[model samples]
Target: MTTGNFPRCNCASGALLQGVELAPGLPALQCPACDGSVLKLDDYRSWQPAPAAVTQPPHVPEIEDRPSARSCPACGRLMQRHRVGSSPDFRVDHCAPCQLVWLDRGEWPALAQAGLAGRLAEILTERWQRRLQNDEIRQQREAALRGKHGDACLDELARIRTWLAEQPHRDELIALLRTGW
Candidate 1:
Protein backbone atom coordinates (compact mmCIF):
# COMPACT_ATOMS: atom_id res chain seq x y z
CA MET A 1 0.00 0.00 0.00
CA THR A 2 3.07 2.23 0.00
CA THR A 3 4.78 3.76 -3.00
CA GLY A 4 8.29 3.88 -1.51
CA ASN A 5 7.30 4.67 2.06
CA PHE A 6 4.29 6.77 0.96
CA PRO A 7 3.91 9.87 -1.17
CA ARG A 8 3.45 13.12 0.69
CA CYS A 9 0.50 15.29 -0.23
CA ASN A 10 1.79 17.65 -2.94
CA CYS A 11 -0.78 20.31 -2.10
CA ALA A 12 1.39 21.79 0.70
CA SER A 13 -0.45 19.85 3.37
CA GLY A 14 3.00 18.65 4.53
CA ALA A 15 1.13 15.58 5.71
CA LEU A 16 1.78 12.04 4.60
CA LEU A 17 -0.99 10.76 2.33
CA GLN A 18 -2.86 7.68 3.47
CA GLY A 19 -2.91 4.78 1.02
CA VAL A 20 -6.45 3.59 0.48
CA GLU A 21 -7.61 0.66 -1.60
CA LEU A 22 -10.34 1.89 -3.90
CA ALA A 23 -10.85 -1.64 -5.30
CA PRO A 24 -9.21 -4.98 -5.00
CA GLY A 25 -5.61 -4.61 -6.21
CA LEU A 26 -6.22 -0.90 -6.82
CA PRO A 27 -4.55 1.43 -4.35
CA ALA A 28 -4.65 5.25 -4.21
CA LEU A 29 -2.95 7.73 -1.90
CA GLN A 30 -5.39 10.09 -0.25
CA CYS A 31 -4.62 13.20 1.72
CA PRO A 32 -5.96 13.08 5.23
CA ALA A 33 -5.70 16.83 5.45
CA CYS A 34 -7.58 17.57 2.24
CA ASP A 35 -9.69 15.96 -0.49
CA GLY A 36 -6.66 15.68 -2.80
CA SER A 37 -5.62 12.21 -3.89
CA VAL A 38 -2.85 10.72 -5.96
CA LEU A 39 -3.98 7.80 -8.05
CA LYS A 40 -2.12 5.41 -10.26
CA LEU A 41 -3.56 5.74 -13.73
CA ASP A 42 -3.31 2.00 -14.45
CA ASP A 43 -5.24 1.15 -11.29
CA TYR A 44 -7.98 3.66 -12.06
CA ARG A 45 -8.28 2.42 -15.64
CA SER A 46 -8.62 -1.16 -14.47
CA TRP A 47 -11.22 -0.19 -11.91
CA GLN A 48 -13.23 1.75 -14.50
CA PRO A 49 -15.83 -0.17 -16.45
CA ALA A 50 -16.44 0.10 -20.17
CA PRO A 51 -17.96 3.46 -21.06
CA ALA A 52 -21.65 3.46 -21.95
CA ALA A 53 -23.30 5.67 -24.55
CA VAL A 54 -24.57 8.81 -22.83
CA THR A 55 -27.78 10.46 -24.08
CA GLN A 56 -26.87 13.79 -22.51
CA PRO A 57 -23.55 14.80 -21.01
CA PRO A 58 -23.56 15.84 -17.36
CA HIS A 59 -22.89 19.48 -16.57
CA VAL A 60 -19.46 20.13 -15.12
CA PRO A 61 -19.09 23.17 -12.92
CA GLU A 62 -16.38 25.64 -13.81
CA ILE A 63 -13.58 25.72 -11.27
CA GLU A 64 -11.28 28.69 -11.08
CA ASP A 65 -7.71 28.32 -12.26
CA ARG A 66 -5.25 28.40 -9.36
CA PRO A 67 -1.81 29.78 -10.13
CA SER A 68 -0.10 27.03 -8.23
CA ALA A 69 2.34 24.40 -9.45
CA ARG A 70 2.18 20.79 -8.29
CA SER A 71 4.72 17.97 -8.36
CA CYS A 72 4.36 14.24 -8.67
CA PRO A 73 4.62 12.68 -5.24
CA ALA A 74 6.09 9.46 -6.64
CA CYS A 75 8.94 11.04 -8.62
CA GLY A 76 9.21 14.42 -6.87
CA ARG A 77 9.09 16.03 -10.34
CA LEU A 78 6.86 18.81 -11.66
CA MET A 79 3.74 17.32 -13.16
CA GLN A 80 2.18 18.53 -16.39
CA ARG A 81 -1.18 20.27 -16.06
CA HIS A 82 -4.13 19.37 -18.26
CA ARG A 83 -7.86 20.03 -18.21
CA VAL A 84 -9.97 16.99 -17.23
CA GLY A 85 -12.37 17.34 -20.19
CA SER A 86 -13.72 19.85 -22.70
CA SER A 87 -14.24 22.32 -19.86
CA PRO A 88 -11.68 25.11 -19.70
CA ASP A 89 -11.65 24.69 -15.92
CA PHE A 90 -10.67 21.81 -13.61
CA ARG A 91 -6.98 21.12 -14.22
CA VAL A 92 -5.24 17.98 -13.03
CA ASP A 93 -1.55 17.23 -12.64
CA HIS A 94 -0.21 14.22 -14.50
CA CYS A 95 3.14 12.47 -14.60
CA ALA A 96 3.09 10.67 -17.93
CA PRO A 97 6.14 8.45 -17.51
CA CYS A 98 5.11 7.44 -14.01
CA GLN A 99 1.46 7.04 -15.06
CA LEU A 100 0.40 8.86 -11.92
CA VAL A 101 -2.25 11.54 -11.57
CA TRP A 102 -2.83 14.12 -8.83
CA LEU A 103 -6.42 15.22 -8.34
CA ASP A 104 -7.06 18.36 -6.35
CA ARG A 105 -9.67 18.59 -3.62
CA GLY A 106 -13.15 17.90 -5.07
CA GLU A 107 -11.73 17.26 -8.53
CA TRP A 108 -12.38 13.51 -8.42
CA PRO A 109 -15.96 13.94 -7.23
CA ALA A 110 -16.45 16.65 -9.84
CA LEU A 111 -15.26 14.29 -12.57
CA ALA A 112 -17.59 11.59 -11.28
CA GLN A 113 -20.49 14.03 -11.25
CA ALA A 114 -19.58 15.08 -14.78
CA GLY A 115 -19.69 11.39 -15.79
CA LEU A 116 -16.03 11.38 -16.86
CA ALA A 117 -14.39 9.31 -14.11
CA GLY A 118 -14.95 6.06 -16.02
CA ARG A 119 -13.68 7.50 -19.30
CA LEU A 120 -10.26 8.72 -18.20
CA ALA A 121 -8.91 6.78 -21.16
CA GLU A 122 -10.66 9.24 -23.47
CA ILE A 123 -8.06 11.92 -22.79
CA LEU A 124 -5.29 9.44 -23.51
CA THR A 125 -6.73 8.41 -26.88
CA GLU A 126 -5.04 9.42 -30.12
CA ARG A 127 -8.34 10.61 -31.57
CA TRP A 128 -9.02 12.96 -28.65
CA GLN A 129 -5.52 14.42 -28.68
CA ARG A 130 -5.64 14.91 -32.45
CA ARG A 131 -9.00 16.64 -32.20
CA LEU A 132 -7.66 19.03 -29.55
CA GLN A 133 -4.65 19.87 -31.73
CA ASN A 134 -6.89 20.38 -34.76
CA ASP A 135 -9.20 22.65 -32.80
CA GLU A 136 -6.27 24.78 -31.61
CA ILE A 137 -4.92 25.02 -35.16
CA ARG A 138 -8.34 26.03 -36.46
CA GLN A 139 -8.61 28.71 -33.78
CA GLN A 140 -5.18 30.10 -34.66
CA ARG A 141 -6.08 30.12 -38.36
CA GLU A 142 -9.35 31.92 -37.68
CA ALA A 143 -7.59 34.54 -35.56
CA ALA A 144 -5.01 35.11 -38.31
CA LEU A 145 -7.75 35.32 -40.90
CA ARG A 146 -9.62 37.89 -38.86
CA GLY A 147 -6.48 39.93 -38.34
CA LYS A 148 -5.65 39.93 -42.04
CA HIS A 149 -9.16 40.38 -43.52
CA GLY A 150 -11.06 42.18 -40.72
CA ASP A 151 -14.45 41.09 -39.35
CA ALA A 152 -16.50 42.57 -42.19
CA CYS A 153 -14.50 40.83 -44.91
CA LEU A 154 -14.58 37.60 -42.93
CA ASP A 155 -18.35 37.80 -42.74
CA GLU A 156 -18.47 38.45 -46.48
CA LEU A 157 -16.18 35.50 -47.09
CA ALA A 158 -18.51 33.31 -45.04
CA ARG A 159 -21.45 34.47 -47.13
CA ILE A 160 -19.47 33.87 -50.33
CA ARG A 161 -18.55 30.37 -49.19
CA THR A 162 -22.22 29.65 -48.47
CA TRP A 163 -23.18 30.88 -51.92
CA LEU A 164 -20.30 29.00 -53.54
CA ALA A 165 -21.60 25.77 -52.03
CA GLU A 166 -24.68 26.21 -54.24
CA GLN A 167 -22.61 27.05 -57.36
CA PRO A 168 -21.38 24.45 -59.84
CA HIS A 169 -17.69 25.53 -59.93
CA ARG A 170 -17.39 25.73 -56.15
CA ASP A 171 -13.83 24.44 -55.91
CA GLU A 172 -12.57 26.88 -58.60
CA LEU A 173 -14.19 29.87 -56.94
CA ILE A 174 -12.84 28.79 -53.54
CA ALA A 175 -9.37 28.51 -54.97
CA LEU A 176 -9.62 32.01 -56.42
CA LEU A 177 -10.88 33.35 -53.10
CA ARG A 178 -7.99 31.72 -51.29
CA THR A 179 -5.53 33.39 -53.66
CA GLY A 180 -7.31 36.76 -53.16
CA TRP A 181 -7.34 37.36 -56.93
Candidate 2:
Protein backbone atom coordinates (compact mmCIF):
# COMPACT_ATOMS: atom_id res chain seq x y z
CA MET A 1 0.00 0.00 0.00
CA THR A 2 1.91 3.02 -1.28
CA THR A 3 1.00 6.70 -1.60
CA GLY A 4 2.58 9.47 -3.63
CA ASN A 5 6.09 8.59 -4.92
CA PHE A 6 7.35 6.37 -2.13
CA PRO A 7 8.21 2.81 -3.10
CA ARG A 8 6.39 -0.11 -1.51
CA CYS A 9 8.01 -2.77 0.68
CA ASN A 10 8.31 -6.37 -0.56
CA CYS A 11 7.47 -7.83 2.79
CA ALA A 12 4.33 -9.87 3.44
CA SER A 13 2.38 -6.76 4.34
CA GLY A 14 3.55 -4.69 1.33
CA ALA A 15 3.50 -1.47 3.33
CA LEU A 16 4.58 1.89 1.98
CA LEU A 17 8.19 2.84 2.73
CA GLN A 18 9.02 6.19 4.28
CA GLY A 19 12.12 8.21 3.48
CA VAL A 20 14.70 8.24 6.26
CA GLU A 21 18.20 9.65 6.50
CA LEU A 22 20.41 6.68 7.32
CA ALA A 23 23.43 8.97 7.69
CA PRO A 24 24.26 12.61 6.97
CA GLY A 25 23.74 12.06 3.25
CA LEU A 26 22.52 8.49 3.08
CA PRO A 27 18.80 8.32 2.54
CA ALA A 28 16.76 5.13 2.47
CA LEU A 29 13.11 4.20 2.04
CA GLN A 30 12.11 2.24 5.11
CA CYS A 31 8.93 0.32 5.69
CA PRO A 32 6.90 1.63 8.58
CA ALA A 33 5.13 -1.70 9.05
CA CYS A 34 7.94 -4.24 8.62
CA ASP A 35 10.94 -2.08 9.50
CA GLY A 36 12.76 -3.19 6.33
CA SER A 37 14.67 -0.61 4.31
CA VAL A 38 15.28 -0.13 0.59
CA LEU A 39 18.57 1.53 -0.22
CA LYS A 40 20.30 2.58 -3.43
CA LEU A 41 23.79 1.21 -3.99
CA ASP A 42 25.17 4.59 -5.00
CA ASP A 43 23.92 6.18 -1.80
CA TYR A 44 25.45 3.35 0.23
CA ARG A 45 28.84 3.59 -1.50
CA SER A 46 29.08 7.34 -1.15
CA TRP A 47 27.94 7.33 2.48
CA GLN A 48 30.64 7.21 5.15
CA PRO A 49 30.72 5.17 8.39
CA ALA A 50 27.09 4.37 9.30
CA PRO A 51 23.82 5.70 10.61
CA ALA A 52 23.78 3.65 13.80
CA ALA A 53 26.44 3.42 16.51
CA VAL A 54 26.63 -0.25 17.44
CA THR A 55 29.92 -1.71 18.67
CA GLN A 56 28.19 -4.98 19.62
CA PRO A 57 25.03 -6.80 18.65
CA PRO A 58 22.05 -6.48 20.93
CA HIS A 59 21.57 -9.23 23.52
CA VAL A 60 19.14 -10.73 21.03
CA PRO A 61 19.02 -8.97 17.71
CA GLU A 62 15.64 -9.21 15.99
CA ILE A 63 16.81 -10.78 12.73
CA GLU A 64 14.23 -12.14 10.30
CA ASP A 65 16.07 -13.59 7.28
CA ARG A 66 13.89 -14.05 4.23
CA PRO A 67 14.82 -17.22 2.36
CA SER A 68 12.53 -16.67 -0.61
CA ALA A 69 13.40 -14.23 -3.42
CA ARG A 70 11.59 -10.93 -3.75
CA SER A 71 11.10 -8.27 -6.40
CA CYS A 72 13.06 -5.03 -6.38
CA PRO A 73 10.99 -1.96 -5.61
CA ALA A 74 12.93 0.35 -7.94
CA CYS A 75 13.04 -1.79 -11.09
CA GLY A 76 10.56 -4.66 -10.51
CA ARG A 77 13.38 -7.18 -10.96
CA LEU A 78 14.19 -10.27 -8.95
CA MET A 79 16.58 -9.70 -6.07
CA GLN A 80 19.59 -11.91 -5.42
CA ARG A 81 20.09 -13.17 -1.88
CA HIS A 82 23.69 -13.11 -0.63
CA ARG A 83 24.79 -14.91 2.53
CA VAL A 84 26.67 -12.60 4.87
CA GLY A 85 28.20 -14.95 7.50
CA SER A 86 27.61 -17.78 10.02
CA SER A 87 27.01 -18.02 13.81
CA PRO A 88 24.14 -15.58 13.19
CA ASP A 89 23.35 -16.55 9.61
CA PHE A 90 21.49 -14.05 7.40
CA ARG A 91 21.17 -13.09 3.73
CA VAL A 92 21.05 -9.68 2.05
CA ASP A 93 18.92 -9.03 -1.03
CA HIS A 94 20.55 -7.20 -3.94
CA CYS A 95 19.09 -6.14 -7.26
CA ALA A 96 21.97 -5.65 -9.68
CA PRO A 97 20.04 -3.91 -12.44
CA CYS A 98 18.39 -1.41 -10.14
CA GLN A 99 21.49 -1.04 -7.95
CA LEU A 100 19.21 -1.30 -4.97
CA VAL A 101 19.20 -3.43 -1.81
CA TRP A 102 16.40 -4.60 0.47
CA LEU A 103 17.58 -5.01 4.01
CA ASP A 104 15.32 -6.67 6.53
CA ARG A 105 14.99 -5.40 10.07
CA GLY A 106 18.07 -5.79 12.29
CA GLU A 107 20.34 -6.79 9.35
CA TRP A 108 22.44 -3.63 9.58
CA PRO A 109 23.10 -4.06 13.25
CA ALA A 110 23.90 -7.75 12.71
CA LEU A 111 26.38 -6.84 9.97
CA ALA A 112 27.99 -4.27 12.23
CA GLN A 113 28.14 -6.86 14.98
CA ALA A 114 29.86 -9.31 12.62
CA GLY A 115 32.31 -6.58 11.49
CA LEU A 116 30.97 -6.68 7.93
CA ALA A 117 28.87 -3.52 7.83
CA GLY A 118 31.48 -1.65 5.73
CA ARG A 119 31.96 -4.55 3.29
CA LEU A 120 28.40 -5.05 2.01
CA ALA A 121 29.47 -4.50 -1.60
CA GLU A 122 32.36 -6.94 -1.23
CA ILE A 123 29.99 -9.50 0.30
CA LEU A 124 27.96 -9.67 -2.94
CA THR A 125 30.98 -10.58 -5.08
CA GLU A 126 31.37 -14.04 -6.63
CA ARG A 127 34.65 -14.74 -4.85
CA TRP A 128 33.19 -13.84 -1.48
CA GLN A 129 30.07 -15.96 -2.08
CA ARG A 130 32.16 -18.94 -3.18
CA ARG A 131 34.36 -18.64 -0.08
CA LEU A 132 31.30 -18.63 2.14
CA GLN A 133 29.92 -21.73 0.41
CA ASN A 134 33.29 -23.49 0.84
CA ASP A 135 33.35 -22.60 4.50
CA GLU A 136 29.86 -24.06 4.99
CA ILE A 137 30.79 -27.27 3.20
CA ARG A 138 33.94 -27.55 5.32
CA GLN A 139 31.89 -27.10 8.47
CA GLN A 140 29.44 -29.82 7.43
CA ARG A 141 32.27 -32.20 6.60
CA GLU A 142 33.93 -31.54 9.98
CA ALA A 143 30.64 -32.13 11.78
CA ALA A 144 30.14 -35.47 10.00
CA LEU A 145 33.73 -36.55 10.78
CA ARG A 146 33.32 -35.64 14.40
CA GLY A 147 30.12 -37.62 14.63
CA LYS A 148 31.68 -40.71 13.04
CA HIS A 149 34.98 -40.66 14.95
CA GLY A 150 33.57 -39.57 18.30
CA ASP A 151 35.15 -36.86 20.49
CA ALA A 152 37.88 -38.82 22.29
CA CYS A 153 39.31 -40.60 19.21
CA LEU A 154 39.07 -37.47 17.03
CA ASP A 155 40.82 -35.33 19.63
CA GLU A 156 43.69 -37.86 19.92
CA LEU A 157 44.04 -38.03 16.13
CA ALA A 158 44.06 -34.22 15.90
CA ARG A 159 46.72 -33.98 18.63
CA ILE A 160 48.83 -36.61 16.88
CA ARG A 161 48.54 -34.86 13.53
CA THR A 162 49.58 -31.52 15.05
CA TRP A 163 52.56 -33.16 16.80
CA LEU A 164 53.60 -35.06 13.64
CA ALA A 165 53.67 -31.88 11.50
CA GLU A 166 56.31 -30.42 13.83
CA GLN A 167 58.62 -33.51 13.69
CA PRO A 168 61.57 -33.54 11.20
CA HIS A 169 61.16 -37.31 10.47
CA ARG A 170 57.34 -37.23 10.22
CA ASP A 171 57.26 -39.19 6.94
CA GLU A 172 59.56 -41.91 8.35
CA LEU A 173 57.34 -42.27 11.43
CA ILE A 174 54.22 -42.66 9.26
CA ALA A 175 56.00 -45.27 7.05
CA LEU A 176 57.16 -47.27 10.11
CA LEU A 177 53.60 -47.24 11.53
CA ARG A 178 52.23 -48.55 8.21
CA THR A 179 54.76 -51.49 8.20
CA GLY A 180 55.16 -52.09 11.92
CA TRP A 181 57.32 -55.05 13.22
Candidate 3:
Protein backbone atom coordinates (compact mmCIF):
# COMPACT_ATOMS: atom_id res chain seq x y z
CA MET A 1 0.00 0.00 0.00
CA THR A 2 1.11 3.60 -0.65
CA THR A 3 2.44 5.51 2.32
CA GLY A 4 2.27 9.23 3.02
CA ASN A 5 -0.42 10.58 5.32
CA PHE A 6 -1.93 7.11 5.75
CA PRO A 7 -0.30 3.87 6.87
CA ARG A 8 0.89 1.59 4.05
CA CYS A 9 0.29 -2.15 3.81
CA ASN A 10 3.23 -4.33 4.85
CA CYS A 11 2.48 -6.82 2.10
CA ALA A 12 4.19 -4.61 -0.49
CA SER A 13 0.85 -4.37 -2.29
CA GLY A 14 1.22 -0.57 -2.85
CA ALA A 15 -2.25 0.12 -1.54
CA LEU A 16 -2.85 2.74 1.11
CA LEU A 17 -4.62 1.49 4.23
CA GLN A 18 -8.05 2.74 5.26
CA GLY A 19 -9.79 2.68 8.61
CA VAL A 20 -12.12 -0.25 9.22
CA GLU A 21 -13.69 -2.22 12.07
CA LEU A 22 -12.45 -5.79 11.73
CA ALA A 23 -14.64 -6.74 14.66
CA PRO A 24 -17.19 -4.68 16.57
CA GLY A 25 -15.33 -1.71 18.07
CA LEU A 26 -11.94 -3.01 16.95
CA PRO A 27 -10.51 -0.40 14.61
CA ALA A 28 -7.82 -1.29 12.09
CA LEU A 29 -6.19 0.06 8.94
CA GLN A 30 -7.09 -2.23 6.08
CA CYS A 31 -5.60 -2.60 2.64
CA PRO A 32 -8.05 -2.54 -0.22
CA ALA A 33 -5.93 -4.43 -2.71
CA CYS A 34 -4.53 -7.24 -0.56
CA ASP A 35 -7.25 -7.37 2.14
CA GLY A 36 -4.51 -7.34 4.79
CA SER A 37 -5.01 -5.38 8.00
CA VAL A 38 -2.77 -3.41 10.31
CA LEU A 39 -4.01 -2.91 13.86
CA LYS A 40 -2.61 -1.32 16.94
CA LEU A 41 -2.10 -3.49 19.99
CA ASP A 42 -3.60 -0.73 22.10
CA ASP A 43 -6.87 -0.98 20.20
CA TYR A 44 -6.81 -4.77 20.44
CA ARG A 45 -6.27 -4.62 24.22
CA SER A 46 -9.47 -2.61 24.61
CA TRP A 47 -11.52 -4.72 22.22
CA GLN A 48 -13.30 -8.03 22.85
CA PRO A 49 -13.86 -10.87 20.41
CA ALA A 50 -17.42 -11.70 19.39
CA PRO A 51 -18.58 -14.96 20.92
CA ALA A 52 -19.17 -17.75 18.43
CA ALA A 53 -21.44 -20.78 18.60
CA VAL A 54 -19.10 -22.82 16.44
CA THR A 55 -16.04 -24.32 18.12
CA GLN A 56 -14.20 -25.86 15.17
CA PRO A 57 -11.58 -24.26 12.94
CA PRO A 58 -12.86 -22.87 9.67
CA HIS A 59 -12.19 -24.85 6.49
CA VAL A 60 -9.41 -22.72 5.09
CA PRO A 61 -7.82 -24.23 2.00
CA GLU A 62 -4.77 -22.10 2.64
CA ILE A 63 -4.34 -18.78 4.40
CA GLU A 64 -2.08 -16.35 2.56
CA ASP A 65 1.27 -16.59 4.34
CA ARG A 66 3.91 -14.07 3.31
CA PRO A 67 6.94 -16.07 4.44
CA SER A 68 9.23 -13.15 3.66
CA ALA A 69 9.78 -10.48 6.28
CA ARG A 70 7.43 -7.53 6.10
CA SER A 71 7.91 -3.92 7.07
CA CYS A 72 5.74 -2.33 9.74
CA PRO A 73 3.15 -0.04 8.21
CA ALA A 74 3.46 2.46 11.00
CA CYS A 75 7.21 2.52 11.62
CA GLY A 76 8.71 1.44 8.26
CA ARG A 77 10.85 -1.13 10.06
CA LEU A 78 10.97 -4.89 9.48
CA MET A 79 8.39 -6.69 11.59
CA GLN A 80 9.02 -9.88 13.51
CA ARG A 81 6.88 -12.93 12.78
CA HIS A 82 5.43 -14.97 15.67
CA ARG A 83 4.06 -18.47 15.15
CA VAL A 84 0.39 -18.73 16.14
CA GLY A 85 -0.49 -22.45 15.87
CA SER A 86 0.53 -25.72 14.27
CA SER A 87 -2.64 -26.73 12.45
CA PRO A 88 -2.67 -24.75 9.18
CA ASP A 89 0.28 -22.96 10.74
CA PHE A 90 0.69 -19.22 10.18
CA ARG A 91 2.65 -16.41 11.68
CA VAL A 92 1.47 -12.92 12.62
CA ASP A 93 3.77 -10.06 11.71
CA HIS A 94 4.44 -7.87 14.73
CA CYS A 95 6.18 -4.59 15.39
CA ALA A 96 6.78 -4.67 19.13
CA PRO A 97 8.33 -1.22 19.38
CA CYS A 98 5.42 0.35 17.55
CA GLN A 99 2.89 -1.94 19.21
CA LEU A 100 1.39 -2.94 15.89
CA VAL A 101 0.31 -6.24 14.33
CA TRP A 102 -0.09 -7.05 10.63
CA LEU A 103 -2.58 -9.75 9.78
CA ASP A 104 -2.59 -11.11 6.26
CA ARG A 105 -5.86 -11.77 4.44
CA GLY A 106 -7.97 -14.36 6.28
CA GLU A 107 -5.43 -14.55 9.12
CA TRP A 108 -7.85 -13.00 11.61
CA PRO A 109 -10.65 -15.36 10.65
CA ALA A 110 -8.27 -18.31 10.89
CA LEU A 111 -7.02 -17.19 14.29
CA ALA A 112 -10.57 -16.77 15.54
CA GLN A 113 -11.51 -20.15 14.13
CA ALA A 114 -8.54 -21.77 15.89
CA GLY A 115 -9.75 -20.33 19.24
CA LEU A 116 -6.72 -18.08 19.40
CA ALA A 117 -8.44 -14.77 18.69
CA GLY A 118 -8.45 -13.81 22.36
CA ARG A 119 -4.81 -14.77 22.86
CA LEU A 120 -3.20 -12.39 20.37
CA ALA A 121 -1.12 -10.66 23.01
CA GLU A 122 -0.05 -13.96 24.50
CA ILE A 123 1.22 -15.18 21.12
CA LEU A 124 3.81 -12.41 20.97
CA THR A 125 5.39 -13.13 24.35
CA GLU A 126 8.75 -14.88 24.85
CA ARG A 127 7.15 -17.76 26.76
CA TRP A 128 4.74 -18.41 23.93
CA GLN A 129 7.51 -18.32 21.31
CA ARG A 130 9.66 -20.66 23.36
CA ARG A 131 6.74 -23.06 23.82
CA LEU A 132 6.07 -23.04 20.09
CA GLN A 133 9.74 -23.76 19.37
CA ASN A 134 9.80 -26.59 21.89
CA ASP A 135 6.65 -28.05 20.43
CA GLU A 136 8.10 -28.06 16.90
CA ILE A 137 11.33 -29.62 18.19
CA ARG A 138 9.37 -32.29 20.04
CA GLN A 139 7.37 -33.06 16.91
CA GLN A 140 10.57 -33.39 14.89
CA ARG A 141 12.10 -35.66 17.52
CA GLU A 142 8.99 -37.86 17.57
CA ALA A 143 8.96 -38.08 13.77
CA ALA A 144 12.60 -39.22 13.83
CA LEU A 145 11.86 -41.78 16.54
CA ARG A 146 8.85 -43.06 14.62
CA GLY A 147 10.94 -43.36 11.47
CA LYS A 148 13.69 -45.37 13.16
CA HIS A 149 11.77 -47.41 15.74
CA GLY A 150 8.40 -47.65 13.92
CA ASP A 151 4.95 -46.89 15.34
CA ALA A 152 4.45 -50.12 17.32
CA CYS A 153 7.65 -49.74 19.29
CA LEU A 154 7.03 -46.04 19.91
CA ASP A 155 3.47 -46.74 21.02
CA GLU A 156 4.63 -49.42 23.42
CA LEU A 157 7.28 -47.10 24.86
CA ALA A 158 4.66 -44.40 25.31
CA ARG A 159 2.37 -46.86 27.08
CA ILE A 160 5.18 -48.01 29.36
CA ARG A 161 6.20 -44.43 30.12
CA THR A 162 2.62 -43.60 31.10
CA TRP A 163 2.36 -46.70 33.29
CA LEU A 164 5.72 -46.02 34.93
CA ALA A 165 4.60 -42.51 35.98
CA GLU A 166 1.92 -44.00 38.30
CA GLN A 167 4.13 -46.61 39.99
CA PRO A 168 5.19 -46.04 43.64
CA HIS A 169 8.81 -47.12 43.04
CA ARG A 170 9.19 -45.51 39.63
CA ASP A 171 12.83 -44.52 40.12
CA GLU A 172 13.77 -47.97 41.41
CA LEU A 173 12.00 -49.61 38.48
CA ILE A 174 13.84 -47.37 36.04
CA ALA A 175 17.16 -48.09 37.79
CA LEU A 176 16.57 -51.85 37.66
CA LEU A 177 15.81 -51.62 33.95
CA ARG A 178 18.98 -49.52 33.42
CA THR A 179 21.02 -52.24 35.16
CA GLY A 180 19.39 -54.99 33.00
CA TRP A 181 17.52 -58.10 34.37
Stretches off by above 4 angstroms in model 2 are 1-6, 23-25, 50-54, 57-60, 87-89, 160-181
Candidate 1's residue-wise lDDT over 7-100, tens digit each? 5775656787887753345578988876577888878876744343222235434443445767778877888777665555577778888888
List per-candidate RMSD values in Å: 5.3, 3.9, 3.4
Best by TM-score: 3
Global lDDT scores for all candidate models? 0.70, 0.78, 0.81
Clashes of each: 0, 0, 2
lDDT of 2 by residue, 40-107 (tens): 88888887864353355555358877767878877777899888886434888999987878888888
Q: Model 1, poorest ten-residue lDDT window? A: 48-57
In model 1, which residue pairs have backbone atoms overlapping below 3 Å?
none
> Which wins on TM-score, candidate 1 or candidate 3?
3
lDDT of 1 at 144: 98
Model 3, 1-181: lDDT tens per residue?
2235446665547777888876677888899988888878999998877675124444543578787888887778899999897653499999998898999888887777777778899999999988987998999999999999999999999999999999999999999989977
